[model samples]
Target: MTLSNTIRWLGMLAVIGGICRLLMTPLELMWGTDNTTALIIGGITGSVFIIIGTAGIYLFQAEKAGVLGFIGFLMTTLGNILVCTMVMIALFVNTALQDPQILEQDLPGPIVPIRIIMMITMNLGYILFGIATIRAKMLPRWGGALMILLVLMTFIPYTDYLFAVVWGLFYIVLGWAVWSRSKNSETKVSVTQ
Candidate 1:
């Protein structure tokens, strides 16, 4: 398929991902992270779609996005992938198998540092992506602004749940922006023809 087509489809997927992300808050509140089903639906399966969606978001404006955009894309993708890994570990290795000690007992080296690094990269990545998105002007500017502000919000105490809600809204706006923009451009092309 053409790149444009791919991006449009991915944007649709982003809508799906956003819905799943919104569900995360309620799922966590209900199941408290122990339910594997909730974990998978809330983030595991959703993350795959989110990665694809965000890739489309970046590629949609790669030309205008430039170097900072590229770096932001990399970090954003990396952070998402890393979170997926951690979620899988939490679900299967920790929950299904019920081997809480296995992670600490069988791990190679210290994992605390790695986790901290992930956290740092994740926060920075979101901020970078937000700035890049705004500068690119391909997606919704408000969504980009929301991304940066949401990262800042993470610093507030007891605001963890807010993330799922806001991020869901962010992706929804992003996807809608992509969808509408492409459709508008296509209409213009047809009119010109």
Candidate 2:
């Protein structure tokens, strides 16, 4: 119910979602299984993070912080939600219902334009969120910085996917940082009491 509680929940969700994505990527690469299945799994796993993040965005508005940081979080949440939803659609509608060969062989119909737009928006949202992280004192500066780096790398045509991997590592580290910070803050509060 409290702001801190919400953030803690969000962090936990991010941890779970991030790990799921990380795991799914390798499975896709190694197994070459159904791409739709992978996206659906990833999307479902990521939905938790989106739910938590949505709450975090609302909570952030009530807390004191710079306008930039607020905007960054807002953009980050919006972008994540947008991308996640797109991925889900792609998975269920495109990959699940339509011929899988369309995507695999680039015989695309509706997916190409939609995916391109989603990718652009999602990447931009992530980059902005990373910048916001730098401004917000709730997390480490390095996490935000790393996100910016990931964004830049992701835009480099061929290296963007690599950035996605790096982004996953950063997500785990950020989650650990959040959990640790929450514990430490609780200890301090208890000690003071």
Candidate 3:
């Protein structure tokens, strides 16, 4: 496949992932506990899609193989993988804990460590991915910059909702960029022909 096609695919994946995570926040907030099924599903889907997209960009050296893209891809890959791993661990923990009520508890014993691990890994992963977005032409550089901001925002205490909103905005920007770029390309090709 062409490099542009690959990038398009990757861009689509990011858009999808961003949207899913954005949507999940509300579900998580409403439930006030881990959405094990959603988390696992999103983790798997996001990882696969991102890998394909990142690989495409790397394989094609999209944009002269800028260090920014490479760094961004590295961060995104690591961060996304970490988040997925955390989700897997949470699933296992939830299953093994055998206490459905554990969800209701605020930071239960076994969950404390998991939560901490999740927080650290998750934030780091996002930071990296946000960086990757910055280096990509798939969307506006501002989207990536905003993603970086969102990543920073996550560090604030009791601001998960704020994080979610910022995160959603990032996706909205990315999605628009991807959609518009693809359309522009198609138009250019048709006109040339």
TM-score of decoy 3: 0.66
lDDT of 3 at 110: 66
Off by over 4 Å in 3: 41-44, 50-61, 99-138, 186-193
Best by TM-score: 1
The model with the greatest lDDT is 1
- lDDT of model 1 at residue 2? 62
Clashing pairs in 1: none
Query: Taking the tens digit of each residue's C-alpha lDDT, what string does model 1 give over 1-193?
Result: 6667777777788778877877888887886644566668867877777777887777777777777877888887888777777677767876757764565564555466666666777788888889989997877899889888878887888888878888778887897777667655631111121
Per-residue lDDT of 24 in model 1: 87
Candidate 2: list runs displaced more than 4 Å. Answer: 50-65, 94-98, 104-117, 186-193
The per-model lDDT (C-alpha) reads: 0.75, 0.58, 0.57
Q: For candidate 2, give the lDDT.
A: 0.58
Model 1 poorest 10 in a row by lDDT: 184-193
Provide the lowest-lDDT 10-residue window in model 2. Answer: 184-193
Candidate 3: the clashing residue pairs are 72-132, 79-125
Q: Give the Å error, residue 13, model 3.
A: 1.7
